[model samples]
Target: MDARPSAWIIAAVVTFYMSAALVMVFVNKAVLNSTPDLPLLFLFIQLIIAVVLLHAGALLTPKIEVPPLDLHTAKKLTPVVLINIVGLVFNMLCLRDVEASFFQIARGLVLPLTISASSIATRSRPSISVSFAATIVTIGFFVGVAPEHTLPTASVPSGLSLFYGFLSSLFIAIHAVLIKSSLPFCSNSTIQLAYWTNAGSAFFLVPFILITGEPGNLLALVSDPKWHMSTLFWGSLITGVFGFLLCVAGLLSIKVTSPITHMFSSAMRSVIQTLLGVCIFHDVLTTNRLISLATILGGTMYYTWLKSNQPPAQSQRPQADQEALDNGDREPKVGWQAPDLDEGLNGKN
Candidate 1:
C-alpha cells in the first residue's frame, strides 16, 4: 500500500483548485452573464482534457493490470444508469439556477444526499438517532439566516434549482453505488468516467444547444480581453482534465471512510470554490447563504461521523480500506486507454 501522493494526484488537485479560482474571477468581471455560452465550452472542453490527462498518466505504468469492475451484474448496474441521467440534469440546473459561488456552496448538498442514498441502499438504515442528528445539523445550518433569501439575479431558482440539485445529489449517491457495484472495473488504474458522462450529457444537451441557439457569443468572449481569457483557458485546461479526476480519486481512495466522510472530504472543492468566489468575484456570503452552507455541512458531518463508527460494508469497497474486495472483474490487461469505468460509477468514474 503506497501511502505517498502520486505525481498525477498532485497534478489533479492543483488543476481543480486553480480552475475554481479563475472561474470566480471571470464571474466577478461580469464576463459570465446569464447563460454564458462559454460555460458549455468549458464543460465539453474540460471533459476532453481530463480524459487526455488520464491517458497520459496511465502511460507511466503501462505494465500494470487494469482492474475493470464486474459490470456483468446488470441488476446492480441498471438502476444506477437510470439515476445518473438525473445527476446530469441536477448539475445543469445548479449551473443554470444557483450559479457562481452559490452553486459552489449549495452543491454541497450532494454530501448529505449521497449519504442518505447510501444509508437507504445498504442494510443498515440511518437510525432514528442518526436521523435526528442529521436534522439538527440541517437546522443549525439555516438558524443563522434570515427569512428573506436573496436569489441569484441571472438564474432565478424557481425553487427548481433546489429540486434539481437534490435530485442530482440522489443520483450522485447512486453513482457511488455504481462505483461500488462496478468496483472491479476501475481498480488499479487512474480511471475517469466524466468524459464519457459528458459525452452522454452532450447527447442530451446538444439538441437544447441547437434549439435555444446556445452557441452564444463564445467567440466574442474569447477575442475580448476583458473576459480574463488567460484565466479561463488555464482553468478549463486544468480543471476539466485534472481537478475533477483527482477529486474522484480522493473519493475512491477513501471509500470505506463512510459516505458522509467521502462527501465531506470532497466538499473541500466547494469550500475552495466559495472562498475563490468571494476573493475573485466579490460574491457575497449572505446570512441566508451562510446558514445554508452551515446546514449542509452539519448534515454532512452528522452522517460521516455516524457512519464511520459502524462496520463498513464489504461489497465493492476500495482497495485502500485494506479489506480484500475483488475489483478484478476482468482478466488483467495492460494498456493506456482504460476500459470505460465511468459508465456506471455514476458518471463520476
Candidate 2:
C-alpha cells in the first residue's frame, strides 16, 4: 500500500508551514520595534533558544539526531556558518528599519541576484526564460522603492533601510550558492546542517554582541521604563520555537508537495504578508508598490514553472536543487533564493 499522506494531511502541513513562516517575520518585526537598539542581542537570543530546543528535541525523539558540537565540524562549516550569520544579521537589520510590507519589495532583487551568483559559481548561463523572469523582478524592484524617494517613512533614517535590505538580499544569494558547498559536510541532511549553523551562530554571536556593544544597548533598554521585559522574553521565545518549527515545516513541505505547490504558497504568503503588514503595522501600500509586488510574484512563479518543465539532464546542479527544495529560503521574509532554491526555498526554509 502507498503510504503517502492524505490530501487533507498535506494541506494541513502546508498551512502550518505557511503560518509558522508568516508569524516568524511579524514577531521578529514586533520584537525589533520594541528593542530597536538590540538587533544583535535579539538574534543572539533567538539562536540560543533554537539551539536549546534542538538539544531538547534530540533528547525527546530518537529520530531527531543533533550531532555533538565539535571543533572539526565547526571548522569545516566555517564558511557556511559565517555567511549564514551575515545573511541573518543583514536580514535582521533590514527588517528592523523598514516597514514589514516593504521588506519583501526591498529584497526583490534576490531572485535575480541568486541567478547571477549561481551562474557565476557554476560557470554557466541560465536559459532565456529564466533570464526574462529575472528582468521582470528587477523592473519590479525599481518600481517599488525608487532610489531618490523623499522618504517612505520619516522615522526610518535616510532611506538606508532599503540599502540594508539590498545587502541582505546579496548575502542571502551568497548563502544559497554556498549551501551546496557546505551540505556535503553534513552528509546532505538539512536538519543536521541547520543544527550546526544555529549552534555555530549562537557560539559566534557572543563576541559579536560584545564587539558591537549591544550589551550596553540591552542594559539601557532594560533600565528604561517604557519597555516591557516580558515582551522581549515572550517574543524571543515564540520566534525561536516557530523558527525551529519553520525548519521542520520546510522539510515536511518538500516531502509532500511538488516544487510548483511550494512556489504558489510563497506567492500567496507574500500577498498575505503584505496584507498583514497593512492591517497590523499600518504600512502604506501604494499603487506602485502593489504593482511591483505583483510583478515580482508573477516573474517568480513563471520562473518556477519553466524550471519544473526542464528535463533532468538539463539541470546543471541536482544537489543544489535538492538542497533548495529541502531547505526553503525564508530569510525572515522568504526573499533570498537560488535560481531553483530561490523559487523553491522562498516558501520558508
Candidate 3:
C-alpha cells in the first residue's frame, strides 16, 4: 500500500471508521445498561465475534491475509493482550456506572497519558507545543468531570467509577507503548495483530468470567421471565458484530491514512458521541462541560497538527519500513507505530 493514499479514499475510510465506532459505543452502552451484571461476559462475546470475523475474512478474502498465532508470537503479545483485557474490562466497569457523556470526558485523559508514557519510554522529550497541548487536555478532563456539572436530577458517577475510568485510560496508555515496542516481533499487519489479540483475549477471559461467577449471572438473566430472549439475543449479536467492525475499520483507516488522520477522526467521534449522549440519553451538559469538551478537542487537534508538521526522524523512518518488509509480505506496516490516542480512546470502550 502507498504510504500516502488519495484524499478521497482517506476520507471515505475515515468516515466509515467513525460511523462504525460511534455506533458500537452506543450499542455496547445499551447492552451494558440492560444487563449491568455481565460486563465481562459482554466483552468476551465481542472478542469471540471479532475472532470469528477476522478468521472468516482471512479465509474468504483474496487480498486480506492473517499471520499465524505461533507460540513465539503469542508469548510476545501476551503482555499487550493482557493490558488490553484490563483496559476493556475496566472500561465497561466505568461505563456501567457513569453516563456516556461523562465517559467521553474522562476518555480525554488518554491523549495526555499516552504522550507522557511515550516520552518516558522513548526518553525523547516532546516539543513545547506538544507539552502545552497535553496540559490543556489534562485540564479539560478535570473541568469536564467536575461535580458542579452534575444536574440536580442526575446521578453522580460514583468514586469507584471515576477511579476505574482513570485506571482504564492508564492501562490503555501503557498498552500503546507496549505495542510500539513490540512491533518488531509481530507481522506488520494490524489485522493480524487485532485477530490474534482478540483470539488470545477470548482464551484468557474465559477463566476470569467463570471465576467471577458471571456465568451464573448470565444464566439468571436468561431465565428471568421479565427479560425478552429475542431482544437480548439480537442486541448482544449486534453489539458483537459492531465491535468487530469497529476494530477492523480502525485498523483499515490507519493502514490507508496516517495515524494523524485517525487521531482527528477519533476526536470528531468523541465530539459526536458527547453530543449524542446529551441529545439521546439526556446527559447533563452544563456550560462547563461544553467548554471542557471544546478544550479537549482543541488540544488534541493541535497536538495532531504539531505531530504531523514535525518531520519524522530521517534515520528511523526508512529503517521502520525496512523492518516491516523483513518481517512479512510487503504490506503496509501497522506495527511501526502504535494506535496512539485514537486507539487508546476507543479501544477502552
Return the TM-score for candidate 2, rounded to 2 decimals: 0.79
Across residues 177-263, which tens digit of lDDT does each residue of candidate 3 receive?
A: 565445455556667777766787788889989999999998998889887667556666786677776666666665675333354
The worst-scoring run of ten residues by lDDT in candidate 2 lies at 338-347
Top candidate by TM-score: 3
Off by over 4 Å in 3: 1-13, 252-265, 304-347
* TM-score order of candidates, top first: 3, 2, 1
lDDT of 3 at 259: 37
* Model 1 lDDT per residue over 200-261, tens place: 44445456555655465666666666776766566566555443444344334433333433
TM-score of each: 0.61, 0.79, 0.83
Q: Rank the candidates by lDDT, best first.
A: 3, 2, 1
In model 2, state the lDDT of residue 166: 73
lDDT of 2 by residue, 160-246 (tens): 777776776776667656655565677657667768877777777789889989999878888889889998999999988887776
Find the candidate with the highest lDDT and give its number.
Answer: 3
